[model samples]
Target: MKHQTSQLEFSRPLQVDRVPRLGSVEKLSAEPKELKALAKRMKLPALHALSAELRATPWRGGGLKVEGHLTADIEQVSVISLEAFRETVSLPVSRYFLPAGAVNDNDQEDDADPISNGWVDLGEVVAEILALDLDPYPRKPGEAFEEHVEIEAEPKPESPFAVLARRKGD
Candidate 1:
């Protein structure tokens, strides 16, 4: 599909309290300019494509659970080669958000965050996940780090006088 470039920011706000009990599924794709903005925000060389399929389910009577898969096409400079190369990132998304001040069951909620102003910004969530998954030290496939090691110099031969002195002492 053709995407017209625009100056609009990337944003998708979902009201946590309005989530249906049966759950809702949504698919999101970033526009060219949105992608560019996100790339700059994340300090990436380039972001060619960004998309996600998310499902939001009401949970614990007041909390929301969001599950999805994220896919992105990005460019990064390889640490080994110092050249820009393309990479495709496909990762699962799972996040739970509880209403601010709401009680959450202790277990299985380690990843939970508090909903702000009754809403969750899905676009920012997508961008944050993408940023978290980027490789800190990118490298091309089949490339291995080879460290430069210096060779040790040979030790000088012991003096003949030293050996003679040792023999005399013996």
Candidate 2:
């Protein structure tokens, strides 16, 4: 039997709250080597293909809107959700250190620690999101995938000196 495919168009309304700030510039700055590794591991070809497909589609709207979808794969959805969580947690961490007023100063050192005032918690959240394993491709609308929560068996306490310490016997 031959299956005929038909195109369907629909519109939905959505409201966006102000995007949450995530992290401080100093905190959000991923090491160049680390980013390169992540990009390499992601295997750009699939992403490139997806980008081409998305680019071919027309997006309607200026500011923002929300819509509901009928299907989605849980694993893929989890990855996207985790990424959004990372952004939300990271952006504010970055913004907390911004100097008062609109003037932008790249070299200002106020010595005020925003982390002491709850910003550090975001770092932990980011770390947790990064730890999860997720599928790269998910069914577009409705789909099912296994969900696994891997609890950190041993939580490592944060240390300011840890950054300066070399690996054991290094």
Candidate 3:
């Protein structure tokens, strides 16, 4: 009888995140009060949608910029730009071997699912959304500002080991 063996290699395609960008810039003609109200309604949903889309993407590092200009008629239109790092997080391929006992009597074979076993979590995504010239168009920009505010806790006192190490003549 003759014996033969086969080898299998697994590769997973890398998924890239799509960053949002400003498509066009235009001006609006309305009163300051009316434009403020309109801008608020228009930008809030778009910002939220962009945030959700960013959360869904595989890549987590990027920054967003929003710029707005007011026209003589007191109309406001904003442009949003996004820049992403070209680097990618590459995942290594894994190899597996099957034992003789694991093979079926009918010449069947069992293979392990690579993804199911080797899943890894990179980390949570952090993004900074900034709006330019916000002093004039305060209403719309401030709506989403509170969500991004970070309240950091004060540092705790060092332990005895740290304190002793810092002491002179250790």
Off by over 4 Å in 1: 1-9, 103-109, 151-170
- Total clashing pairs for each candidate: 0, 19, 0
Model 2 lDDT tens row, 1-170:
22222221111111111212321121132344433433344432111110000001111211111111111112122333332211111111111222123224453644222222111222222222332323355333433456888886887776857755755436
lDDT of 1 by residue, 25-136 (tens): 9789999998989888888889999999999998777888889999999999898999899989898999888777874566464558887767777777788888898889
Winning candidate number (lDDT): 1
Candidate 1 has what TM-score?
0.79
Rank by TM-score (best first)? 1, 2, 3
- lDDT by residue (tens digit), candidate 3, 39-58: 35434322211111112221
For lDDT, candidate 1 versus 3, the one ahead is 1
lDDT of 2: 0.25
TM-score of each: 0.79, 0.18, 0.14
Q: Give me the candidate number with maximum TM-score.
A: 1
Q: Compare candidates 2 and 3 on lDDT and give the better one.
A: 3
**CA-only RMSD, every prediction:** 6.5, 22.0, 22.2
